[model samples]
Target: MYRDHSVGVVMPAYNEEGFVGDVICDLPEFVDRVYVIDDCSTDGTWDEIREAASRDAAADDEPVAETALLADGGDSALSERATIGDPVGRVIPIRHRENRGAGGAIKTGYLAAVGDDMDVTVTVDADGQMDLEQMPRLIDPIVDGEAEYAKGNRLLYREFRQDMPRFRFLGNSILTFLTKIASGYWKTMDPQNGYTAISGYALANVGVESMYEYYGYCNDLLVKLNAKGMRVADVAIPAIYGDEASSISYPTYIRRVSWMLFKNFCWRLKVKYLVLDFHPLALFYVFGTATAALGVLGGLWSLYVKYANGDPLFVRASLSLLLFLIGSLFLMFAMLFDMQVNEQKEVQIRE
Candidate 1:
């Protein structure tokens, strides 16, 4: 119940029996409801949750005193009356029938929060990679009407140099660049960062029908929100790296990320140009691609003709060079304009 709003924390777990209880115990006490979602774990995760819930229910029913003092200055100790109180545990554990991946677990948590009518839903990984102490700071902007979604940027961490993985560091950098182009949030860094908090209104607005279910979930959500005109803001949060093992394979990683990138790019073209009618950027992109393709084809044809004739190179060389140069310049300018437009959009939102 921070800032007049009920905060719900969702921790998605799968085969996380050892760490699940730790996560539940570590969550802040002020969180009105903490939902532990077991995405069909094969281990004793369900049993652990049941045990925790039972213990919590018992604690909630513990006896507490309620006393009223008289105006006659009665002793403070004797004026109180003991009454049975609600358990200290407000955490609820939910289990899924089958495996739905991390994204699916998140969607489940989100739907639950929405049903509960919570003011905000904060998604925290069950592996405990994110700092729980920074939860309030991440939720503050959304609560204050400054942004619809708030994301944590690990690179902004003051001590990012300490122990961040090299591969993850490089992968995040490349993906961030590509996602900015696809999602139109050029100002955002670490688009793959999943430590995010969203306002209830925004969550409801972002319908879950077409949400991603794999590793691409975070990036896909960013694009969807951008297309829906929801503003996303980044908050500085430190990275916590430990024994968490990543199960992502290179082939699967490439396929998922490529599909998401293409989907977002096409969606952006359709919405920003056709549906919204924002600017001429779409036309420029189309024209640039066509011109560049034509120029490449023309150059190849000219070279073939010259090879067959074994004659004058003047006509072929001049036309090919001219078209290639003009097409390349046009394509470059189009990309530059797209970047500028995206930057301007971010600036306007901030202002």
Candidate 2:
């Protein structure tokens, strides 16, 4: 265990038969448990996970510590090592009766990890895109008490920027911006990146069952974390793309997640600024939104009046522009106030 903390890895697999075995076998030896949740794959993914578990149990008596696969440039004999040596950790395979989305699978993993009393839980995708070697970096912040949640940021490096697909990179940027406003984590990016680690304390406190169970789960989780005043860190990680097909449709995904973020933003304002502890930023937001709505409606009414009757529209235009300008300024001030209040909430990692 790193830093005397019990570490666990949760892999959510959905028809990832080609890569699930390799992902499981490559986990670091320090991990105490591995939870593989098969989300009702139509393929042979469950069979592969069962076989991996059988191999692990069969080799319980072997002294494979030194020969086991190391995260630091290990040999490519994964299948052989997996079948003939003790696994890095106990593999607990869980299967869903029907296909729950990625978020649902992760929730199942988190519940199991919490139940096992693990100190830290890291999420690794079953598609083999995330680097298992980077597990330590992801969990270190949580272990060190620097952050309650740490997530990989693929956009930090130039090579990653070039490696990610253009469409995905653009979409990630937009979502990241919205998440910053919604979650109050101004310094964090790559909101859609699923490679992350969370302290068990934070996970348990966040109410796993109430979290979003769809593709926007990551973003929604961030908002909840912020509402609870949990610290978050963004660890730089390289982007690794493989032959795995993406299930997301960019247009639909962006629209749906955008709406989710808007709702989450409102919810955060209500819970954190209004319900939990009163803050003036909430007033700024309410006044700004109301004023902005009135300004837009007034402008539209003025335009209609101008077309319907040959009346002078200068006064109406000036009033509408004044309202719009004032409303925009108030909203800008509210955002600045929010940033100032949350600046200290960010997780500061000491090297």
Candidate 3:
């Protein structure tokens, strides 16, 4: 156990066949359990997990649970859940009946951690990009009662993100800005970073079943945490880039996630402000967005009418400008209020 807390690492693997074994072996001894989820990789990633689990001379006789989860609607080659354990720690390997993406794999690991009564759970990808030595740092805030959820932030500075690919860095920046508004965690960045630790309380309460099952799950989880008033911390950490190719299709992934965030934004406002308690920020956001949209539409209409006919444009253009400014002011105020309301909910854990 790390600092008297039962810490578990959730490593989600896809087609990471060759490198998966090393990532599993690199986990610190303090971790009480490691959940390696194989999302039905087309490669031999499952075999690598089994090989790594046997490194400690694991005992496969003692099964945690003998039951199998119902497979997804189609024919899946995967089997029931199985775990390997000796004396030091347990290595639980779960294979999805079908490919459920990275987020779905992590959610399976999260539920496994929750099921085993783990105190703290941390997520690490199986590609060996994350530095396992910093695992303690990620678990510190959650163990100390400072934050329920703590994540590594790789985009805090230029040097921190230097090793990241230029395209990935650029896309991450755009998503970070949009996620700030959507998740209402203005102080945090790098919503897509997967290196994170979450407490059992937050895990059980965050409603993991409803979380997104794709690349944008991190962003979706942030929205859920904000609505539930869970404290979050952003810890500065470095990322290692290697020869592994990204599995995500950036163009399609970003488009779908962006739409998901828009829907989540609306849901969060209602849950946080209307359902639980009454807050004017919800109204401010609604009116501000509506007026800003109307202003842009009105401005375009006025320009079209002026060009099509000889109608005067001054009054109409001026009205559009006025509406846009008012909407902008309202949006600014709403964001400020949001930041204030969540001020204590965020902690910047700089190294």
The number of the candidate with the highest TM-score is 3
| Candidate 2 CA-lDDT value | 0.81
What is the Cα-based TM-score of model 1?
0.80
Assess every candidate by TM-score. 0.80, 0.89, 0.91
User: Weakest 10 consecutive residues, lDDT, candidate 1?
Assistant: 77-86
* Residue runs of model 3 more than 4 Å from their true location after superposition: 58-89
lDDT of 3 by residue, 169-232 (tens): 7888888988999999999999999999999999989998788989998999999999999999
Q: In model 2, what is the error at residue 89, expressed in angstroms?
A: 5.9
lDDT of 2 by residue, 208-276 (tens): 767777888899999999999998988888757789998889999899899999999999999999999
Rank the models by TM-score, top first: 3, 2, 1
Tens digit of lDDT per residue, candidate 1, span 1-351?
788887888777888776666667677656777667788889888677667656654555433221111233322221121111122366656666667788877776776666566788898987768889988887888888878888888776646834656776777777888887788787888777788888888888887556787777888888878777777778777767677776667457656786788778778878866797666777776777777777778778888877998767777767777777777777677667767765533421221
Pick the winner on TM-score between candidates 1 and 2: 2
Clash tally, candidates in order: 3, 0, 0
Q: Which candidate should be chosen as best, given lDDT against the real structure?
A: 3
- Candidate 2 is scored at a TM of 0.89
